[model samples]
Target: MKKRNLIGIVLLLVLLLGILPISSLALDEPALNSKKILLIDTASERTLIDRMADARAEPASLTKIMTALVVLDAVDRGTVSLDQNITASAAVLSDMVEDGSTSNIVPGETMSIR
Candidate 1:
């Protein structure tokens, strides 16, 4: 009877230990606190989460997307080739340095579009 009770206690302890860690590892949904937030599935074109998505708000840092789109369109139209080499201008380098952008490039250095 003593051995049976000991074995049962050991088994219960092991089961709780295993289940507790797994339960704790479960991810909680993120709490987004912003004026407007939009989460979309790019592949499916599905709006997963939309919080005032349609409301016109000042585009801050969103201009990068527009710039990228323009560049991509230009590339597609054969206006800009991917293999084209670009030399870093002094003004551009100065701006990058002032903006504290990280890069291995130096002023006057030439780099090819990848």
Candidate 2:
């Protein structure tokens, strides 16, 4: 009877240990240390958290988001297909090379949409 009670106690402790961290995580909010941050709920159009959200900063790679949206919209409208081939133009290749960007594709090389 005591051995069974000991095993039960151990199992109960293990269960509590596993659950405590997860419950703590659900209760706690993470610390954000960024100049600008925005968290929104798309469903309700609610802003959950915003820190310096209005401040405009230099957008270096953020332009990629617009590019992706446009590409996805085109794909959705059947204007571009995934299997369609795109050839790298000489101007594009030269520009990329001059900018010290690395690419697997050579000039005039054809690649699939993906």
Candidate 3:
């Protein structure tokens, strides 16, 4: 009886482990309403969601220039426009280095895409 219970529990765990990832994928990419997203755990310094987050290039104004280019791409695709306001969230700001050069955008502040 004990052996049967253990087997049942193991099977249940295996089924749940297999189903969880598929169920998460069915969330329509988390409904973020964005073309791509990246999420990291600040405490663990580990990546949670890694979709094009590691886009590679030499570090030539990598931060500001890349940011501008993404905004431009969104503009070109008609998903966002130069006149549209985009608010910088805490998550976005968290990606920045406090002592490093910056675009000077404050968290929660809304600015135009242009």
Candidate 4:
């Protein structure tokens, strides 16, 4: 009975040793933290650097230029004309003043394009 118990303990140790190595090898690789980015030279029309630039958090105000381009295109296509006069009613002026949009247009003022 003593010999049987010693043999059982040795077999258990051998099984645990075999399983430990397999589990260690199965661990995932460490994650990559770095990302690649591009920098361009406007005058040369080429890539100045092909490396990671400063990390940007979020895109802000990037579409404003595109919005301006679309509005200009609409005006150029005659969908809008400079001769069109816009009157600032009390409601429009109040909203502009409340929202703090840049313009000196007063209430009840008539505005025409130059």
The digit string of per-residue lDDT tens for model 2 on 1-114 reads 999999999999999888776666675677878789889999999999988899977555665677678878889999998778888888866675354533466888887876
TM-score of each: 0.41, 0.46, 0.42, 0.30
Best by TM-score: 2
lDDT of each: 0.79, 0.79, 0.76, 0.67
Each prediction's total of clashing residue pairs, residues at least 3 apart in sequence or on different chains, is 0, 0, 0, 0
For residues 3-94, write the lDDT of model 1, one tens digit per residue: 99999999999988887766578799788888798999999999999999999776656656775688778899999887788787888666
Clashing residue pairs, backbone N/CA/C < 3 A, model 2: none
Clashes in predicted model 2: 0
- True-structure RMSD, every candidate: 9.8, 8.3, 15.2, 18.1
Judge candidate 2 against the unseen true structure and give its global Cα lDDT, from 0 to 1.
0.79
Flag regions of model 4 displaced more than 4 Å: 1-71, 97-102
* Model 2: CA > 4 A from native: 3-33, 81-114
Candidate 1 residue pairs in backbone clash: none
44-114 per-residue lDDT for model 4 (tens digits): 99986655566653333544566557757867998866677767788755664354543566777887742
